[model samples]
Target: MSPRNTRPTTPRSGTRQSPRVALTPRAAELVRRLRAEHGPLMFHQSGGCCDGSSPMCYPYGEFRTGASDVLLAELGVDGVAEPVGFWMSADQFERWCHTHLTVDVVPGRGSGFSLEAPEGVRFLVRSRLLTDDETRRLGPGGPSHGDASADTSAHSRSGGPGRA
Candidate 1:
């Protein structure tokens, strides 16, 4: 009988690190669903363009480790993170540990979160800004593109016109 090939392939290394966020129940559900549908998603914060912070979800294909963060390890079948046990760049891990923002895995339309900066600053993005590719990659029944506008309208209705 011929011996069978039993060599295991080495895992790929140096993927972008997942951002840290406080996950609400809603956000957690969204992450679970995305992982099942797509390979993996990424979260990042960019401060160059707009004033308000933005959250973005990237398809596995578009994800990369660009001096920002590196994938540490898979967080079971539901999520991922960069801890000592996982394969992460030293800088990425250090940044995650020291960042003042708190990250959570909650139920949301996509696998990302927004923060309200300490000084009453808003850190979120509009659904309209999401490209069709992002929506599609996020999979079915996830947060729709109109959700951003809808959220603003709901807030306006509750706060009324005269309130600061």
Candidate 2:
């Protein structure tokens, strides 16, 4: 018998509210290890230029976020004191706002700047269209650091309520 590297960390059983972003179990395990080595961490997906399309992880506050960036989620991993913040460029978010992202670990050398690069594994994003319920729960503009309010209006499974 072989040991498994992945496990379910978030409730995907359709009972709990779904997050805009989540981590695969393997990714979560790696996050714990990285946290041990680097204190706290944050992730940013630039979606273009030097970063290419891979998500980059760094020690918290190492990367300077500006008004053009949006926080997509704060992912929780067991044994870690603070949640890992995941941010995306605002333009990228606007294009991908309809999808739910899952951060997964893959074997490859990604951006040299990402902390995990030296570990021989990289973080990547997997996505699926947000379920109708999830879209409404997350509200129209996606998650903001201070926003607690969500719009629960009825929107069809075909698409969210006009992306407004």
> Evaluated with lDDT, which candidate comes out highest?
2
Error of 2 at 145 (Å): 6.8
What Cα-based lDDT does every candidate model obtain? Answer: 0.31, 0.67
Kindly list the per-residue Cα lDDT of model 1 for residues 1-164, writing each as its tens digit: 00011111222322221222233333444545554555344444343345233444333324333333333222222344311111223343444332323223323333223222321323232222334543344344211111212211112245522122
Give the alpha carbon lDDT tens digit for every residue of 87-140 in model 2.
777788889988888889999998989999999999998889989877666654
Please give the distance, in angstroms, between residue 110's alpha carbon in candidate 1 and its true position after superposition. Answer: 9.9
> Residue 12 in candidate 1 has what lDDT?
32
Candidate 1 segments whose C-alpha is farther than 4 A from its true place = 1-21, 48-51, 68-98, 103-164
Q: What lDDT, from 0 to 1, does candidate 2 have? A: 0.67
TM-scores for all candidates: the values are 0.33, 0.76
Highest-TM-score candidate = 2
Runs with alpha carbons beyond 4 Å of true place in candidate 2: 1-18, 145-164
Specify the poorest-scoring 10-residue window by lDDT in model 2: 147-156
Model 2 earns a TM-score of 0.76
Report per-prediction Cα RMSD to one decimal: 18.7, 12.0
